[model samples]
Target: MIQKAQEFMNENHFADVSRVQCLLRKMMSKEYHGLIDQIKEYQDPHAIFNIHGGNNLIAPTASQAEQKLVEKPADEIKKDKE
Candidate 1:
């Protein structure tokens, strides 16, 4: 069933994320706890995001960016406030 869902996602290039999430929720609800775990193992977030078509780019390092932001001088902050 998960494989079929994945194939459907691939075939429908413009599928809606909310709809797919809803369908997955319904499937999960009808199953027992053990089956739910198996379903979760099969439902890969990266694969789903890729199917929905994301920017395949790696994101900038957040810690580095935050460090740079925090390291800004008081003078620089005041200048920007002008």
Candidate 2:
């Protein structure tokens, strides 16, 4: 799954500093105790921002989120901005 996620990330045009734990949870295969450390080590505050939600974050390199976003309907895109 991590390999798949990395592939997904690579296609989106994000960066290494953006793969936060929140994003990882979306693809989680098991519980992670090191989530916080992972987020701080990755997520890009400038591009993705809001790495402080409780899940405590998100960021990426081509990111799975962006890859999913690429598949989103036009209306969904509008909703994300709002």
lDDT string for model 2 (1-82, tens) is 3434444443444555355445776655444424323333222223333333345354434335532323555356446645
Candidate 1 C-alpha lDDT tens digits along 12-50 = 656864576567767655443232233222233233222
Cα shift from native, residue 44, model 1 (Å): 9.7
TM-score of structure candidate 2: 0.26
Model 1 residue 45 CA deviation (Å) reads 12
Candidate 1's C-alpha runs over 4 A off are 30-82
**Which lDDT values do the candidates have, in the order given?**
0.44, 0.42
Clashes per model (N, Cα, C within 3 A): 0, 10
- Taking all chains together, the TM-score of candidate 1 against the true structure is 0.32
Pairs in clash, predicted candidate 1: none
TM-score of each: 0.32, 0.26
